[model samples]
Target: MSKLWLNSDKNESVFIKLFQIINNKYPNYASQWLNSLKDFGKDWEDEISNNISKVFGPEYNDRWEEAATGYAEFCTEALRAQVFFEKHGYYKASSYSDIVKECYHDADYMKVRYLPGQYLSHYIWPHHQKMLRHFVRELIPKIICEVSIFYEVGVGCGMYSQRSLQMMPKAYGVGYDISDYALEFTFNVIKKHNLQERYEIKNQDIISSPIEKKADFIISQEVLEHLEDPQNFINGLYNATRPGGWGYITAAINAGHTDHIFLYRNPEEVRTQIEKAGWSIYDEQIESNYMEKPIELRPTIVGYLARR
Candidate 1:
């Protein structure tokens, strides 16, 4: 295998091992991806590596190869979706029911492939890493109020809620998701961290059954593009947040994935939608997957720290 992309002294064995597994399975693309990550600084790499180890325990050792395969397969599927989007100007999956039937209801696909791949992408994918950084550094720190209660909408891999509980030790998290697999994964994650007492997972859809009690902090990441009516979803988020509360919401723009339904053309479209929902954008970041692309074709992530 090629030399590790991250610093040798960092003791990032879990991360390096995952990379090796990917390289062994896919030599060419893995090598190119690792090479591209050489410029990713040590501090950022170290932080992500540590978070990965914390979130995934010894079970990851046995499943590293499976996770690596999942990552590769997921990327392949995403690329195919992106190509289709470029050709047709929309995501392949159009309806919430279709996504629920095809992606969310498939237990093997969610547990063994999509969820694991998405968990790794939080650390490996450059744009995802940027969004994670924004969540940890920019969004989390800006919440000056005491976060007694927080809500994590669409708790996919449960990383964001786990991070929130970690950062705000006194805060309790209520995670809502429509997918049973997602709730299960999130439960296991928080249980692994011994945060089960501080966090709770509910198999509920906030879009349909909005939280009756408002929270001081709410975070919904990469969920906007998954919904058919994101404006209403945004309004629900706003309603679920207490006055003077803080929210961190993220959406994908011109980015295609197997289950992504609604298409966001640009960051301003997302910003306007959030503003229309009565959120005052406090801080925001837009990170593109590519350094340069036609304005309409760029795959980007837009994250906002908003006040209710």
Candidate 2:
């Protein structure tokens, strides 16, 4: 295999630490799994490291060594999910159905599977940060150049909301999610960033809860597939957005995560759902940054902006 980003001393250290931890917990899988990332070439290697730095901010250098422990758990969960896929095939359950709903809203499930720090550090920071960074640069300004009120659904750890609030000096934010852990995490983040006056976190289900007021801009990331009814969620988004307002929305396709129940075959399917929700798609992006384990096929993150 060609040289990978992991070949670098810094990146290698993180991976090695993660592997050692994983090996100690579950032997033999770490080395084999880490090797799968090697063939992705230098580009992916750079993307991963750069995005991680961007996500963790100035403190990343200080904490990354310790953060590997969380990443190990995250990787282990992904491995377990992959094993489920290999054994039972792609998990296909209707979004918002009883089974998937219980997985998302149940206290035990949320604690064990949806812990915000572990989820953000292990998955979003390492894997999806590039996509988010891309949004802040390319999508955010293009969609909502300036807004007084910003709303977000599935505010996982509040990174997106915090960043958006920071970037837009005049804007205040309101975010909604089902997880108590996520709400608490977001609350702490807003305080840590001295943005307490600028944001509030509500532990509300966006689909069923009243929006309170229409927003000048809205955002929801990595949330659609977990819903039992994504189209209804989209319509709710449309209802929450004010006329002439546009927002960023994201979903993953063929991503076999522990909680992802909806199976979107392609970006087109996502787009079709958005249009069906009575919104117009203005801009869109799709990228599969990592390949499936033991197979080269990548699961994609599809992003789009819908205008009200």
- TM-score leader: 1
Candidate 1 whole-model C-alpha lDDT, 0 to 1: 0.83
Please provide TM-scores, in order, for all candidate models, with all chains considered together: 0.92, 0.74
User: Mind giving the per-residue lDDT tens digits that candidate 2 earns over 203-267?
Assistant: 88767786869898989888888776788888888888988887788898766667777777778
- Candidate 1 lDDT over residue span 271-307, tens digit each: 9999999999989899887657786888899999999
Model 1: ten consecutive residues of lowest lDDT:
4-13
Q: Scored by CA lDDT, what does every candidate get?
A: 0.83, 0.66
Segments of candidate 2 deviating more than 4 angstroms: 1-67, 86-89, 92-113, 116-127, 292-297
